[model samples]
Target: MISSEDHARLSQAIREAEDLTTGEIVVVVSEQASSYRSFPVLWALLAALVVPWPLIAITTLGPARIFLIQLLVALFLSIFLSFPSRRHALVPRFIKRARARETARREFLGRGLTRTRERTGVLIYVALAEHHAEIMADTGIADRVGPEVWRGIVDELTDRIREGRLTDGLVAAVRRTGAILAEHAPPRFDDVDELPNKVFVL
Candidate 1:
């Protein structure tokens, strides 16, 4: 969902952020956390099932005709609800947040954020489809920082995403995270780049 220009800018932001702290910051932006294909199917099925009941109650149509109408309703709904916005609407907010969090956690581990020296790695993850953002801090930083700090960053990032300022939001989040890390885990003399300072767009 990010352009090449935005990618370059995000990478630059990461590099600058890493300059002041030993902490490894990785940013991941994903189009979505989950496909949620089942949502369209579930909605289509429910609408079809309900449609047949009303027809059965009010119409003198034969059972076969009623069944055919139900099938057609299901087909139409499946096509209409297959749209991304429609499908997303069918999913509960809690489910979207949970999936986004899970995706963030997976990215944090899969990207080796936990394997950094001194365990001072932080992951800034954004899921565009779910309109969610999260910051994951390893023990080295988390022990020194409170959850409220991360929450505040997430809130700002989410606002930016909602305003269609994703790149701007990410850049700000990276800077803020770097400042926090610099305070808690300033660069070491032997500090080396332990992770790729680039935005992973999934």
Candidate 2:
């Protein structure tokens, strides 16, 4: 969902953020955690299955007409669900959040954020389809920064995203997190660039 210009700016922000701290920060964006791909077909089938019942109970429609009506209902609903926006809306809120968090955690591990020398890697993750964001922190940093601190950053970033300021929100979150890391884990003489600074997109 990010544009080319935004990607460059976000990468630059990451570069700057890592300059003053040994802690590693990674950002990842995903179109969606899971497709929930079968939902549309299920909805269409359900629409077809349910139509016959109402037709049989409430109306004196003949079998042929009822079947035709059921077929039409199924076709219409299937076509409606073919739209990505409509299909996404059918996914439950809890499922969306859970999937986003799961995906973020997977990325944290997949990108080697958990293997940093000081256990100080943090991930700023966004799932655009669900409009959800998560901040995943490793033990070294979370031990110093309370849960409330991380919550505040997630909340603020979510608000900015809702306002359509994703790039700005990410940069601000990176800077804010960088300041906190600099305070708790300032660069050492032997500090290494343990991870890349690019914005990971999936």
Candidate 3:
């Protein structure tokens, strides 16, 4: 479980690692509830049924014909509402945004900022009325370092970046953290680990 203390630490780390104005960094870690993209899909399916049912029933001669028409309508609705291919001439901006968002989530997870393998995208609720800015990560980060340590790292990074000392601070923090981890838990020859040597930068 993540705590407020850890959130504060991570916020500081992020500040130190990136150059930003004061009050730019805000970290809030909390439990996440269900995400419902399916809701829109269901609504679309229902709307398709309602819109076509009357027309099909009135125009079709037999029950079988009506059923087929309904089926076709459902299929068309699903395809229409679903993400269209880039080949479509209508709206390219939406496609680009979706592609960028996917890439960002993948990158974030690859860096070890999030724990879940499920691609839920960057938004994670940390507490009541608070959220963390996960848009920076393309792939979610794993919880290799304990929450406390991770939070501390974020806090330090955030502070340094806000102070315009991002480059030096991040290098020092990564080295320091690596040394501490090495001293405490040196890897064995048989271990099959593939962790990155460098810390992720924003």
lDDT of 3 by residue, 65-141 (tens): 66666677777665565543312322244443454445445554554445422221122112111122122321322
Q: Residue by residue across 144-176, what tens digits does model 2's lDDT show?
A: 999888789889998999998988999999989
Query: Using alpha carbons, what is the TM-score of model 2?
Result: 0.89
TM-score of candidate 1 against the unseen true structure? 0.94
Ten residues in sequence with the least summed lDDT for candidate 2 = 32-41
Instruction: Provide the overall lDDT of each model, using Cα atoms, as 2-decimal numbers.
Output: 0.92, 0.90, 0.40
Best lDDT among the predictions, by candidate number? 1
Say which candidate scores most in TM-score.
1
By the lDDT metric, which is better: model 2 or model 3?
A: 2
Ranking by lDDT: 1, 2, 3
Q: Candidate 2, overall lDDT?
A: 0.90
1 versus 2: better lDDT goes to: 1
